[model samples]
Target: MNASVDTAGAMAPQDVVNLARYPIGDPDSPERAALVKSLRDYLDEHQYVALPDFILPNARSRAVTEIDAVSHEANHNSSFRNCYLSRVKNPSLPEDHPINIFEDTSNWILAYDQLPDSSPLKTLYHWDAVREFVAEIVGEDRLYDNEDPYQPVNVLIYNDGDRSSWHFDSVNAFTVTLMLQAPEAGGDFELVPNLREGELDNPDGIRAVLEGKGETPVPVAREPGALCIFRGCTALHRVAPVKGATQRLMAVMVYEDQPGVVGRPDVNETIFGPRVAANG
Candidate 1:
């Protein structure tokens, strides 16, 4: 039942070391062609891609465990709201461009600088594996390049109830969600794709949903052990109320335009407590 040991019962203790314990990708096996092909097709035509056994089977189990632990540790009595974003230092674009305009309140959580390599919940935003897959689908030569070469990775965990509202992520490219655990009911991920390029820009789409001015967002039910990859930058999405005692758990790996970038610090401290710097 131990993650570190292989099938033969050989004790390889280091094999199970968390994110920091191991490198992001194995350069020797640089690309998984079959995986890239299928993933590319899924991303091209659909708003989301579901990858089974995406993580090492053992690692997936670990992720599930960590997610449950965080949910149990949740301040249930604490204010239940919608979505939590990784904290950044300067959330205000200009001196006073309505900081409240960007304010998001979805029952959620953050695992930014606070989690360590040892923490299974730490967001591993490694771009190598994802970039390769994306490049294959979007055509590396055609996709938009990140100004920064080495992109920073961050993981997001959501534990919300009926109050979890609809919203969109600021990052504009593909967003990866690895389902570590599934809720019994509700908790479906609904999306309004191409909002970035369509008549519905994110701000307006979110506003429409909040104001009840438009139709309901499209729904995408994510199952445990399935990788949910979607273009969320502009798309409006939300986690419907999580029913049953078991909370929904997902390992969200996100890439940023700027590596090592942190979202609003005050927000981070407010929700997940103080930030803990990751060891480079």
Candidate 2:
């Protein structure tokens, strides 16, 4: 899996990833094997893992430049919703119920189709070794790139004051992301692990947190060029409000369990904004 011998259509590992440290391209190397095992162990224990400098700094800069050129076109969304993603209050429930608590969230996103072909983001995502390495870390036999035109990859942009509200992913699965840029302050990621890991519901724990009376979820810091794998499904997580002038950018990569999977039109429209919604 050396860069010189990479087959057609695959990006050179060193071009995007720091192979000297991670050695993702060298599958047989003991260092790579141990790295995967340690990553898996950490994820198994914390339901999340982040590898600093997973992407080369220069490549990250290029990806940022590419995004800045199209920043004006990024899809913008701002809304107030409960963890369940419902904007309306549940009148049937008490006013102080978790369902009645709404939180503010805002951000912009660049869909996969919007990125230019020269984007290093695409190069890293297109690399099979990257996907295979992710599979190993997540304990999956294999992972397939999402076939959807707009969902396969995306750059999540968080400007000053932007944040995501505490919420659980509707579906239970792993989400992969790479940090391209980080805000000067705030924009911290907080996770409350296993909030609803199984059918069992920890109402007291969830209700306490929603009421701001529970244990504070520790913030996880990820620097630029870091790759993060998170099991946010069933876990209440959120990004704190960003501060300062620097924008926080994270590349979210989608990997499906099955092949040929595309996004649902209605949901896709909600995430990708009017551009894809109009064309789709």
Candidate 3:
């Protein structure tokens, strides 16, 4: 991504993402086909793909500004959860089991409602070409925007001492995220992919990873303007505690296999806080 490359004139919202390298707008182009195939190969092998320079410098800088402005209104969440993403532990399992292991977690969540319709994030999330490209890479026949008041998109802010505990995403969904800014130190994204295979419960493997013994975790390299697609259903992932005064900003966009999907009430409450958690 050429941080110094300046576009002489005004560009469209989609142009914010470097279409020159991605060429996603032209679905039939040979370059677009090659890009999809390349990303698929990487995702199939590693269960994750990070495309750097996905967004231009102007967009990245503007997104950071937009997110920072509303960040104070974001819900400051701090708590603990096990790898299973549950507040409660399984007493039936042994103490050393992964289910019983808890980790500290903290972050600020900027819900979709906080952003205006003109927000660059909304433009990127609603773009049909970008959505279609994501579906193609994930091998989904078609994907629809998540129809939720606050769950459709979010800006996750991690400041000094904030971190995400290890957890698995919904087994049936793929996660798409865009990096807007990076902190001075720490705040690393790390994950152990394919730790659990098939239907068999890899208790020992899970326990070993939680205990930080075997199975080294892979650290994902992402810079501002990078777009990432990852299948985290079976992976154990966490954000290392951020260090320094600068805050780390990342935007997450949600899409569904089918239309009319909304988050569970309880889930919404926990993530977005109670003020706007009521059913719409």
Candidate 4:
């Protein structure tokens, strides 16, 4: 579909996305086609793709400001989690076992439902062009935002000393994140590609990563306003602790293969809060 204006008269995809830098709205454009092909190929080979300055600088600055202004409202949570990104403990295993090692931490999150309509990040998430472009690059027919309002979008914040522990995604096939701000030190994203594909039990490999004894994991360059597409289900990854007083901010866009499917109630309550309501 051609780009359309939203209620505020901003271009559906253009106002938010830097089309000249990344022509995701117009698939027929040669630049768009080439960009999609290259990104897909890179993701296929490396299990993730990073596009620096995916959002224009001015718009990105606005997003950062908005998120910062609302930082006080963010819900902060932390807990110990295993490599599977779950809090469940296998009591039968020894404490030192990778399956039993739960050292993951959490960061603050502002769910989509909490974002106002004027939020640039929220508007961008609802754009058809953006969704279509991501689907094409990920080799999916199309992508659907989660029916659960809170699950579809989020602003992940990493304050000083905050970090996401090493783990894999539990549900989504892929994750699309845009960095809005970077701390002065740390908050690096590290990934081990294809670490446990097709294997249910890869304790040795998991333990190696947890123990920091495996092959050197790839460290993704930190670029504010960059869009990162990660195949989290296949690649084990984590966000290093934020070191400085500055907070790290990112917008995480969640998509689903099926339509009208919201996140489970329990998951919603766990991530957001009890006041969370279903999108429908």
lDDT tens digits, residue span 8-112, model 2: 543455788888888888778898899999999999988888899988888889889889999889988889998877799979988877788899999999998
Error of 3 at 85 (Å): 0.2
TM-score of 1: 0.60
Task: Give the better candidate number (1 or 4) by TM-score.
Answer: 4
Tens digits of per-residue lDDT, candidate 1, 43-121, equal 7766666665444446556656554554534322234333224323345454222222333434544353323334433
Candidate 2: global Cα-lDDT? 0.84
Better of 1 and 3 by TM-score: 3
All candidates' lDDT scores?
0.49, 0.84, 0.84, 0.82
* Clashes found in each candidate (C-alpha, N, C closer than 3 A): 17, 0, 0, 0
Candidate 2 stretches with Cα past 4 Å from truth are 1-11
RMSD of 1: 8.5
Give the runs in model 4 whose Cα sits over 4 Å from its true position. 1-12, 277-280
Mark the regions of model 1 whose C-alpha exceeds 4 Å error after superposition. 1-31, 69-105, 110-116, 119-127, 134-163, 196-216, 258-260, 274-280
lDDT of 4 by residue, 29-67 (tens): 998889999999999999999989778877788778778
Error of 2 at 195 (Å): 1.2
